[model samples]
Target: MSAANAPTQSQLEKDIELIKLIRSRGLVPLITAEERPDVPRLSDVQGDVIYGFPKASLNHALNIEWFFFFRIADSGSFKAGLSNPDFKPTSSEDVKNNLLKIGKARQEAKLSGEEVKRVKLQQYQIAFSKTGLLVLGIQDGIADARFDQRCMRDDRVFLGDQGKWDDLFDKPGYNEKDGSAHDVNNPRALHGVFVIAGDDDKECADITEKLKGIFKSSIEIPENGIVQGHVRPERHLEHFGFRDGISQPAIRNLEYPLPGQNQVDPGVIVTGYKGDPVGSKRPDWAKNGAMLVFRKLEQSVVAWDNYMLDHGQDYKDVPGGKAGVNPELSQEDGAKLLAARLVGRWPSGAPIALKETSLKDDPKMGEDPKRNNNFDYSVYDVPGVSAQTPSDYYCPFTAHVRKTAPRNLDPYVARQYLESGSIIRAGITYGPEVTQKERDDKKDSEEEKFKRGLLFVCYASHLDSGFVRQTTGYGNNDFFPITGLVPNNHGQDPIIGGPPAKGSSGEERDANLDAKPAKPFANGDQLDIKLKVPGDTLNRYQVTGHVEIQPLTQAVIDFPFFVTSRGGEYFFVPSIPTLKTWGTAN
Candidate 1:
């Protein structure tokens, strides 16, 4: 995909028209791609567009992030806050300049044999919801249909449907009839989110102090928005102990592309770029801006761990066990394996399709980008094994990774269309580490003592076909199709899946996994596989001697509520020029 800086004459005219429309609506002046300083070009690994917000940046330890929610109490005060040189919203020019300075600093530090303690400056980006635009006094007539349709709504994009709410073990806050913590009516409803990220807590705190003073009475800092720091030790891991953000699509304009990373068109993410993913006519003001989806997902770690302990042993008879490749593992080890299958990768970040034996041994493999994310479940050729099958035998079809991407399995009209579903995930795990004392206390509830979960943030041009489709169509659907596999309702995603309704009594919803019998081993031992379908109480097959007649073994497990939605909103991250205009507007 070509860079967004250059547009044809007709397109340029459209941009001009867009600017006029925005001005007519009294919108803050937005920076156009043409006016902004060129993003410093660098190698694929170092230089790129959309600085400071990508999966690679999360690998840096000591990283601290702050989420600020502000309500425009007085439009003039808010404008004054934006105009303040010290607390002015960061522009793309600011980001590029900062990156160049940081790069130079790193090089100087390395040459001078000096330790770089912390970045003196903090990096932040500003985005606003439809409510925020209104608060800023932009008329509703200026907003486009797509933005109005998505950003103006308060329902949870993934779980708001009545059917899905009924199916979940614990409904999201918005789903409840009574106003709750996450309800739209709650005071937590926010108009804008300002994200500040730094090298350490001190830097973040310093920036937060400055921002508080700058905005003062214009913004409301809710108690909930105070500060949710990222957890330690397992910095990148989610509360459930799985490495998050392992899978991300490679953007077209990047210089360096990692192995197995799918290259997506710029239009798929940035608005008005060539090959716009939405394929619908949009207002010119929408160009160059991207939609942001935010969700606060809280995890029940204690409940999740306990469920694994009770059911992990059941998977011992799974693929590895039947193939005789797996060692005789204790109950704890068995449970760990079961957890990995649900997550699609081990805690070490290694894909299960590559390593199935011991989760701890292949830490090196997981760290290597070339090998870590290179597996395709649809058609995989296992290393050192000659027999290649098109089935997702090694990796379950319902695995979190499989359900989200589906890779070649996507039935979209073309391959590029399939790649459009990709979104840049900028999520951070928020919560405290479980203490040994907390782990040992059998009677104590960990959920009560600790608040932990994921702050899911992603950028996409189209919410309906991108983030919404992945969460609702892929994450929620159980009967997601796979070629050559029989049509089976594989149940909800074990980790993030929600049931159609809360199960009767205390029993959780049942999720099915299709366990294909292992191919005849090279060692010449025929493994006997016995499949048990839960709720199969009638013994109908027992009388017919058809126990082994079923082509695939279906293992049904009780899946409980693992993750719950706290709150979220949709926002539009405008260009730097537009922000500047907003600040200086009369």
Candidate 2:
């Protein structure tokens, strides 16, 4: 065929590749099967695989998760369990099918004027930690050298070793004296983790029993290794009162795109995709696999709330304090503003970058899908308000969102280099709600003393640039993005950043705010701003400088750790076909 007249690959060929990819790798939420109108739906893709992502099932009210630490007593028995058709691993396809059936049932019930009975379907996924694979003598199956290296290393070193932990201004319980360390003995020795999520407690318990039956003879469940997590009754808020999972990056090559979401290349998440940024080619068997980083973080609700109560007034001294813009703010309201600044968002999940005034009282703004998660840090004015100068002056550079994502604030080279650092977070909060009475009582029952936090889970293509860099590089460092205006020895992330030195008491972290620039006014001088109209050819303003407004600067008191790491592990979620092969392997 002539080069100019050569035919393009048919839609059927593309569909086959897509199915093979989904089957080999897992499908996440928001992926659509039909990307192009010309493509005829394949039977495999149309049936059950075409449904919604399992982790994001809309009808799921409560989710229960269990992390199992098991040792393989007999490889043969383990393989037998893998071979059982009833115990086969749940694929994204299975989840989709279940959701479709449930949706249909609900619709039929609604049409018949009958109550839609809750479906008690249980969903489960299994992943092997590096230790689990080693225990099973399957280390050779891991083809990525980075995964292999990280898998072999302890998570303590990845997060913060004894030295790094000691350097923090406020020491976490896990890093405290041996007898007092939280999670000191629990998650560190785990071999593998099994996650079971369902609609309610009964479904979760049933699934747990089924899992026990599969590995009863081949593994040992550690006393404390099994942890449970559920969605809070308030919906998406975490223990610290911040809305989470709201700013996840959208994956490209999906069937559908979420409105206002920025889509990243598939290589940023899935292995073997063209967007994979690593220099080396992944192994054949490792194709379609993803690296999973798990962490059990406990949040001290009392301590966090206490810190805010004690230090809220100090926020006014910090740069970018809204008191400069809104002179009517009280000390209490200023404290609330400070709390919002530390979190990078208001309690309602509204990004501070979206408005000049604190949206702490405006819950509706934060709840509006069209407003939240919509602003970029590089812009100065609110959307549609172009008369103001463009800058990152409103939101502090070290704000949690800015530190993690940076968006246009990052240098072009660094931005491109860190593309692989993007990851998909699939975590749920664990712990009971502490009542106001409990806080005032100053005494916690034994059950209330039980640690509560997030079961942090994230999937990435590479550990080094993904989770590792995001933590050790960005989360730990104070002088990130390297903007010239940032002060020397600036403060680390207040919410998650560790202190500069260990064993220190009452230390403070530095933050620089890009306060609105001001010019000096002489006695009897009047100020006037020529507002730019919509169709003005040039949007420009000139302010005469008698004295410039210095950037707001302040130090935050370093308190005891609020979020402490309990345990974690690295695992590889492989293709179903690979699991089948392992099931039959000698």
Candidate 3:
């Protein structure tokens, strides 16, 4: 209300122009409160903190983006570029300020009866690899083993890359035996990457070129540096035709938690926060920074579709088939059902856990945040459902979602996963949609220049506890969730899971689609006991004794290869102050 603090007319005009630019690009400038969990306070560290990725909804955050990877040539010049206003990365406070300005400008326009226009603003963020740190003389390191591992090329054995690397990532002159680039500081080494995003491709390109020019002497920008990704126009789907970016964890303070969304402390994501694995031992300059995991996963759409079609009619009996019920489904419907079960959601983004028997996508439920991510894969959350928990009777334990986040499977496991194993996914689909020819042929054509895949990007404070664990430990591992159920191993994650085979395509894996607990769970179906109150009169299911599940006729499904990791690297996103420090000194 104070006049002194009021924004000047010029500033208001500037904000309105910003809004218009965004609208011109067909984007909404407003970021949902529930989706901005990574944004920190403006006053925190004098507005020095930077977002690990765009702190907006998936649509807004990745509308149009570019990942420009470069190698350091001159350390002094590269360090100086960090402080250059034109070349520096965008700060978290800058994003928050823009959101506020846009809001204020919209309100002013509404009051003045002026037509409000949306805004699109480009954001630039920087992250450096371990070698980049050494190049910049941060010799002590950030103290993360997985990150300090140096080259993701070496991680191929565990990540299952199997030498299917893009030429750009698999540059020459690396020690083939040890998987180390012969010269760590070579001009071809991946030192750092710059992420630029907005709604304009030309504008993004211009910025990319500008930054390249600015750091021309300090770095070498390869052809792959121009790789761009975009969010599909239809329902925000990925190349796989499924709605993506659902079920992201809610940060404790940054966002208003959605129903059933696991909310963790900022330390779980940003360093120097409450839940960080390294705790206060992290260097002071590394505060507010997060580790970035960048993986380019190429999807074989044709192969996946054919595999689903081939197995669609072979439906598996549920709940251990105790009732000897195997629902007959048409091949068409069966294929859809198979895909949904594999992804743990329909193409519309609805959770298969909530709509287990449905063969069609629930557009309403999928788009409804209040319901889409509200399921916990247990009968305890299903209304009016009487329990005898059958153990993944609805959502298969091998389903992509369940494997990545076994929410509420076990209280301790869920808590532990939320605390350390979670990652903030801000990836965007890269390449192009499959062509009609490719679809008709039931395979991607050799003539097709661009392949379709996901530019998988995620963030976390501890690389080991976050992305690495989710991929190698859970997604790729069998016998996870440790449910002590019969059959022991549930299966590998159907989407991204890789069995313990290194240097292989991971083309085939086993999954228990119809898992059953040796004995039925005691608790009957009821609203989550966690939500129950002392005097609440809600009916609760309580079947005291044990319930037994009979063995199913069909239990395991042979999973096929779908996602192939082309290449990736782990980078450290430093704080604004840290950048300034690096720029001013070594």
Compare the candidates by TM-score and give the number of the best one: 3
lDDT values, one for every candidate: 0.57, 0.56, 0.66
TM-score list, all predictions: 0.72, 0.72, 0.77
Output the number of the lDDT-best candidate: 3
Q: Give the poorly placed runs of model 2, Cα more than 4 Å off.
A: 1-60, 97-119, 141-146, 151-158, 161-189, 278-280, 317-327, 330-332, 356-361, 382-392, 410-414, 435-438, 441-449, 485-489, 499-560
lDDT of 3 by residue, 1-586 (tens): 1356556767766655554433311112333222233444432322212233332242333367788898888898888787676765676656656555555556676689986544567777788888788877787657776666557765665564543677667655554234452246455668888888776688688878788777778988776666678766663678777887777776665544556777777788778777888866777888878888888887888888888789876666443342333456667777887898888898888887764433457888787776777767767545555443435667777789887866765532556654578787777787777888887888875553658788888888898888878876777666666654454567788778653222356454333325574654552111121223347678543322112232465355455667777788778888777788887884
**Which candidate, 2 or 3, would have the higher lDDT against the true structure?**
3
Model 1 alpha-carbon miss at residue 76, Å = 3.0
TM-score, model 1 to reference = 0.72
List residue ranges in candidate 3 displaced over 4 A. Answer: 1-62, 98-116, 171-183, 318-330, 355-360, 381-390, 411-414, 485-487, 499-557
Question: Per-residue alpha-carbon lDDT of model 1 for 221-285, expressed as tens digits?
Answer: 65556545564566556788776666777556432345666667656766666546543566555
**Residue 466 in candidate 3 has what lDDT?**
88
Best-first order by lDDT: 3, 1, 2
Listed per candidate, the RMSD to the true structure in angstroms reads 12.7, 15.2, 13.2
Candidates sorted on TM-score, descending = 3, 2, 1
